[model samples]
Target chain A: MLILTCPYCGVDCDETELGAGGEAHLKRHGPGSTDEEFESYIFQRENPRGVHFERWRHAMGCGKWFHAARDTATLEVFGTYVAQAFEPPQEIKDKITAKRPGWTWRDVA
Target chain B: MSDVVTALDGATFNGTIAVEDAGLTGMITLRGDFASTSFQNAVTGVSGVNFPGKGEVNSVGDRGLAWMSPDELLMIVPYDQTNAALAEITENLGEEHHLAVNVSDARAVFRLRGNGNVIREVLAKLTPADLRVAALPTGRVRRTRLSQVPAAFWFSAEDEATLICFRSVAEYVFGLLRQSAAEGSEIGYF
Candidate 1:
């Protein structure tokens, strides 16, 4: 079981005590009005292999939504930060030193 | 007062044996000022279950119990010992910084245990508590939402893997478990 750090409760919670909020922080663009845009927004998914950002909810305990960084394959959690906070954990600094696709300093970095 | 023994209706699951008030168990809700020394001493003196100076739980004997939070603890004792336990704590602590509330009436419990996938099937339909042995391990306790009702989940040291849920939610929760079991079998689950 993964220990999810609840940004609100300030505690590491068991995975069983939480629910995933699906792909985290998905962004939307202006009125493209095209099938590709709609499909990419709804059906397309990015199953990242490395450190991925995601949103999680502490369903059974405190009802709070927060961003959690986890490694997809090994499930090694990087850290969890409050939803409103703009800064990422200091540990992610080196890993995100360079930019990648679908990433912004506001997101991946 | 006359002892009332009314059959608690819809308070259990089907195909699973349930025994209520059959064994000795006690439930106590301790609400006190965590900042007050009197409150701390009263709890430690009563059940030998001291507040978690750091963690979320602390215990004295195998049976003595205490679960931690910011300012409250839900304590448990053997069935016959609840009243005396509350009274002693109250008398010693006085009414300065503590209040020993007997929640025996508000709370109740049912122990569930059996061989086969019986226990697993029941729990799968009930709460989100991980039934995985590695996660919960036997004897570990967690207070969580079971069937959307506030309750506690613990592994028992019995021959069969035993678990307990709140008595008030027994009926609905049990019915759901039975339904899930039947649904599992209907889908060819053994």
Candidate 2:
């Protein structure tokens, strides 16, 4: 029973209480994008060896998107934090803001 | 009535003891740096009960009380006593970065005695508290879970321990207890 700390819930609960979705930072194509683009996004995955980003679900408590850093080789989870509710660093923010819901890249500040 | 639900909507079985809506008790969750003198004084002034302060219970003339945690405590008293307790507490500390939350409405407590040992076994299957006398010696409190419910389990008296649940989930919790008990058997809990 591994005690995984939830960034949002702020509790060290059993891993059974959570479900791993997949790698985080997986980009999904927008509606106007081509089918090929979406397919690549859906099927392709980067199986990193260390410090990989992943998405986890809080099955027993509040359901929210949270990011975590895990070492692939050791399976040691270093830290977990809530997903950015707003803007992030310049690079990631630019990419995300470009494809945000209801707004195009040009629409974001 | 075979199944008597209390005023708080908690179901009370014929064999189990129930004390519902006993009084509007005030439960204040206190959190601050444990090593801070201000925090210590804040607790003392409010309860007149010295901070057993680290991880234990300290009583104050049967009214004000403090139950400790890792870095926090739960101060409980009669509802009417909160204003005065708060007054003395704030007066002593003046200004500090601490939390004093009134969680009175969030919890419902039960006096689970008589067959406590049996109940403890039933709970051990789901909770993490070690009910063994050696592990959780009498008069001790341990915070753990009940299925999915977060609870504070403690021996409140010689043969009694209080089971507190969130107000919104009290009814569901009561049902869970009834289902866990087998039919045609006695609740011979120690």
Q: Cα deviation in Å at residue A57, candidate 1?
A: 7.4
Candidate achieving the largest DockQ: 1
Q: Which stretches of model 1 miss by more than 4 angstroms?
A: A1-59, A62-78, A81-109, B2-25, B31-41, B49-63, B66-71, B78-83, B91-100, B116-118, B158-168, B180-190
lDDT of 1 by residue, B34-99 (tens): 788878777777778656542245544434454434455767776568899888888987757655
Q: Could you report the DockQ of all the candidates, in the order they appear? A: 0.14, 0.04
Task: Report lDDT (Cα) of residue B11, candidate 1.
Answer: 46
- Model 1, position B159, has a per-residue lDDT of 25
